[model samples]
Target: MNEIRVFCPATIANISCGFDVLGVALDSVGDEMVVRKIPEKGIRITKLEGQDLPKETERNVAGVAGLTLLEASGYDGGFEIEIYKKIKAGSGIGSSAASSSGAVWAMNELLGRPFSKIDLVRFAMEGERLASAVAHADNVAPALYGGFTLVRSYDPLDVVSIPNPPELYATVIHPQIEVKTSDSRSVLRTKITLAQGIKQWGNVGGLIAGLFTNDYDLIGRSLEDHIVEPIRSILIPGFDNVKSEALNAGALGCGISGSGPSIFAFCKGETIAKKVSESMKEVYQDIGIDHDVHVSKINTNGVRAI
Candidate 1:
């Protein structure tokens, strides 16, 4: 195919206790991208719509990611990327990740999949590094691997795709506020107590076990974040109320979606997911904060041709 159009799912990173390691893709919300092979020898951002963003090849996330892939592949021809941004930047829902992963994924398809998923993630990390000054893969891994992914290690670059419970659903609330990943990270403390570290490790292990064993209750209990949430929650408005109301609405668990501004809750079914959405919105509404909410199943297909 000379050109490819794809739907790149938005992802929820850090998943409470997982913190830079675990993430899942949302089926309902994301960005659309169209990639085309070009005779030119370099990447370009041909068209950008939806959000006001940089279109320059060197400045945009998609461009940076595409360029990384192009450099790695040694592909003689270049590719042009057109991004239709649905996820707002700095909303903490993997906005940069969708663009970055989508661009590289499309280019990989056009080149007949010369690189593996892991390689694509490494390429996408460049775009993330440009955006947040850190090459974290919590968002990009899920956007590429789909369902749930655990970043086991960075040195060897091992990413493990986890099996999600079939009935799992997610309700996400994005308050119309910008929370740049860099700014959010700035609020985090550099140190944690040994007790907190042990608790976090146990929760991470419990969460993975809950998913593997289909234990919804275990998942809920394990969603607690001892280290990051306390400091980061201060950045988001009505975060405590949102989490409380979501649990009351029968959500399995609720936590900040990424850094801040967006919160996500896991539910057993769509009905509870919608109920959780209402609960999330109610908090924002009472506070007179503009917001966007979405209820979605775990997207088994992360980035796909559309």
Candidate 2:
């Protein structure tokens, strides 16, 4: 395909229990991108909409990611990209990831699928690094692998796809505040106590097992974040109230999504997910903070062509 249009997905990373490791993609929310193979030698950003960001190939995340892929492929020609952003930047939900993943994915598709998903993920990280100063794969992995993914090891770049429970749903509330990934990441402590580490490990294991076994209660119990939430929760307003209300509304559990500002909750069914959304919406409304709420079934197919 010389020109391909694709639906790139938004992602919730760090999933409360698996800081810097776990992520899931949303089925209905994301960005749209069109990539065209050209006779030129380098990547170019032909269009960008819905967000105020740089258009330069080197400065833009998508452009950077596409360039990374091109550099590795030794392809004779380059690509032209158009990005239509639906996910807001600094919204704590994989804004940069959609563009980055979309670009590299489309590029790989046009080249007869020479690169693996893991390879595409590595290329996407270059864009993320430009956006957040960290080449982490939590968001990109799920954006490409779909549903839930765990960054098992970074040294060898191992990413494991976790089965999504059929009834599992996610509700996310994004207050009108912006929390840049770089800014949110700065507040994190470099070290954690042994007790904290053990708790985090067990919860991560529990979450993975819960999904595998379709145990909603175990999933709920495993949603605890003993390490990152304490330090980062202060960054978002109404976080405590939202989490409490979500739990009260019968949500499985609730906690910060990604870095901050957007909070996500897990529910067993769509009805509870919608109910949890309202509970979360009410908190921001009561706080007089403008917000957006979304309820989505987990996306099993990450990115796809239109």
Candidate 3:
């Protein structure tokens, strides 16, 4: 095939306790892109929709990811990419990962699928690094592979898909605010106390076990983040009120999605998910903060032809 179109779902990174090591895909919102082969021998971005973004191929996440794949696969031909972004940038919801993964996914189809899923993630991380200056795979891995993902290690780039409970639902609320990823990372402390570290590791272990054993209560109890959330939540308006309201509204757990301005909650069913969404929205509305809410099942399929 000389051309292909793909849709990549938005992802929630740092799922409360994971903090740069865990993520899950959300089915409701994402970005779409089309990649077509061209006569020129380089990657080019031909169109962009939804919001104004940088068009330079090297500067844009999609272009950087596509170029990385083309160079790695030794493809000499050029390709043009068109992006229709649905996920808002700086919303703490893997917006760049959707574009990056979607671009490489379409390019892979056009190139007859030369790269593996892991390689696609590696290439996508280049795009993420261009945007965030961090090569973490919590967002990219889940965006590329779908469902819940665990970045086991970054030294050798080990990523594995964790089992997902079928009945679990997600409610994501994106407030009308911008929180730059760089600033978010900058505000984080570089080290943690031994006591906090032990607690975090135990919670991480419990979360993994909860996913494996399908224990909803364990998952709820393990969704505590004592490190990143305490610092970053201060940046998001009404964060504490919204999280408390979500839990009171039947959400299992709630926390900041990725960095800030967007908050997500985990619920057991669609009805409760909707209720949690409304409760969270009420908090934002009462504060005069414009926001968008999405209630969805976890996306099992990540980037795919559409």
Candidate 4:
């Protein structure tokens, strides 16, 4: 069979408040998967790259995703998978999701396409389950549809593509630290007050509305998250100072991305985005931690073959 290749972009979910719900695709970073049929029966991952990546199916996130798709699609064949890892795993950068989503997408194409993007998303969650023990749709949604997305309810099977706001930039900072998703979730309070829940949902609604209308002010105003951010920020080193620096550099809004250790700051244009990125980098430098910053736009094309 001809080789099938797929690419999935990195995503930052929650954006400070919309925990487990909102996420946006980044234009410049992601991972790739290649799949092809072999005459054998079991799965064989021929190659794996990147830091701390595992090759065994039980440990390889992409391998698990491909096997899950094969089982769901009722295709019985030996498959050779090669994962080109670009996104670093465990930086709260949706690395596992990209691998899973890319594997599912590549295998679907190789099998003459059996699953829809929505169906593949559910299948991809198997990989996340292997890693994070929860079915997260944030990375999967953006990896499938591109642009901004809202996973309103995972169990109820709801996913929507949030409209892209114009003149927006996402400045991402990844510090050299590893915070597992399980640990991150454990840090969150199981029960939040009614007032806090209201505020969180209010920001969510406002973020949605702002995206639809391209209102930067509303988006900025809505980006504030008093609940999850406060609890999760403690996991990352120099989190508060970095956030303050990003905002002080003229960011429209700034907050922790997904779990922690990676911060995303939104700005109105490239100039402010660059400034915010520089400011974030400076904070990490001051803290004596190695970091990387990217001033990127929202990726509108989600995942596609290269």
Candidate 5:
């Protein structure tokens, strides 16, 4: 028998304009885990904390990811998994992706570490798809590689890494509101015009280039969205106020993190990050909603064994 432990950091995917192709890891929001290998050929999750996480391996996000890893790596063994959930559910913080990444990472270690980082991301995305009904690489990439990543390609193969950026700070605000992924997806438009699509691609390209060059102005200017956010932003109260407040508070760039309710802002330093967090909180407060705010730096390492 063998034991393994892993920690998966929460992530902000899409980052507004990039939509399904960008993400970053947050140091404060995440999940923890402990695992033990068993002789049997089935999986079991014995414990889970935080609200309403499934205990049975068959029904759990981590369990699905573990199964995916086993299939990808050709391994069979029972796993007893314990989950410590730090990120809140429905926070737009990639909670499902974190669990999936953690499980796959832990299982890989227990099985002598067979899959590569991209392979782990693919497996984790598979598990997330089970939860969200879509295979998105945005969360999985940062959960596996850390820092700010551009999912340059995702399909039959996934390729990405941290882009070079000046020291950056992120502020995340999660309002205590629940919006199901299915509902969020339903609100989005399924089609886009050629002009709007081209603008989005241009912004995405600028974002990638800005990261590589540490160009804050370019990054801020490029944080434009012609799709997704416009539709879903309506679901969140005080969204416009929050965004306005963040930028007014000196965030280089700010937008909805993944979907709704939880928002993230990018700042040049801790001072602006804290200010942005406060501003975001104030917006929510004015709207009569309770919220939690975190000011954290980029987590260069996505998930780690502890």
Candidate 6:
């Protein structure tokens, strides 16, 4: 293929209970990019739209991801990338992951699919590092692999796909506020007590089992975050009110999406999902924060040709 266009879905990293280990792909809200092969030898970002973003290849996540893929594949030919970013940066949703995954996904297609999904995720992590200064795979893995994902190990970059509950729906609300990712990471404690750690791990295990067994209540009960949410939710306006209302409105659970400013809840069905969305929005509206809300099923397809 001389050119390829790919759409990569947005992602929710941490997923409340899992912290940095788990993430899920959303059906809507993503970034699109087109990669066109050229005669010259290097990667170039020809266009960027939807948000004010760096156009430089090295500074841009999509460009850096595409470049990384090219280097790894030993491809010397030139390519130009055009990005249409629908996901907002610092929304706590995986905006950077969408760009990073979209670029490498399109690049792999242009090069006749040279890399595995896992390798593409690895390249995307490098792109993520450019944005967040941390080469974390929680968001990138789900953006590449779809559904729910577990970053079982980072030393070898091991990512495992977890089964998604068929009836599960996600409600996401992105408040129009700036919450720097660096600031989010800086507020986190380096360590947690053993009791807190144990509770978190137990919840993580329950969540995974719930997904596999289609146990909706187990999934709801397991959505507790004892470590990250308490510290990070303070950064988001109306976070506690939104989460409480969502749970009261039939959401299985709700918490900060990734870091802050974007909150997400999981519901058993579309009706409950919509209710959760409305409840979350009401809180934001009361706080006078401009926001965007999305209710969607789990994206089974992460990144795909358009």
Candidate with maximal lDDT: 1
lDDT of 5 by residue, 256-298 (tens): 8886568888888788899889889988888888898989888
Q: Which of the predicted structures, 2 or 5, would earn the higher lDDT when compared with the native?
A: 2
Runs of candidate 4 exceeding 4 Å displacement = none
Off by over 4 Å in 2: none
**Per-candidate TM vs. native?**
0.99, 0.98, 0.98, 0.96, 0.95, 0.98
Model 3 misplaced stretches (Cα beyond 4 Å) = none
| Evaluation by TM-score, superior candidate among 4 and 6 | 6
| Ten-residue stretch with the least lDDT total in model 5 | 157-166
1 or 4, greater by TM-score: 1
Task: Please estimate how well model 3 matches the true structure, expressed as its whole-model Cα lDDT.
Answer: 0.90
Q: On residues 36-116, what C-alpha lDDT tens digit does candidate 2 reach at each position?
A: 999989998999999999999999999999999999999999999999999988888899999999999999999999999
lDDT of 5: 0.84
Higher-TM-score candidate of 3 and 5: 3
Per-residue lDDT tens digits of candidate 3, residues 114-182? 889999999999999998887678889999999999998988989999987888999999999888888
In candidate 2, list every pair of residues with a backbone clash: none
Steric clash pairs (candidate 4): none
Q: Per lDDT, what order, best first?
A: 1, 2, 6, 3, 4, 5
| Candidate 1 lowest-lDDT run of ten | 177-186
Cα displacement (Å) at residue 170, model 4: 0.9
Stretches of candidate 1 off by over 4 Å are: none
Model 5, position 223: C-alpha lDDT score: 86
Output the worst ten-in-a-row residue range by lDDT, candidate 2: 177-186
Q: Number of clashing pairs, model 4?
A: 0
Model 6 TM-score (2 dp) = 0.98
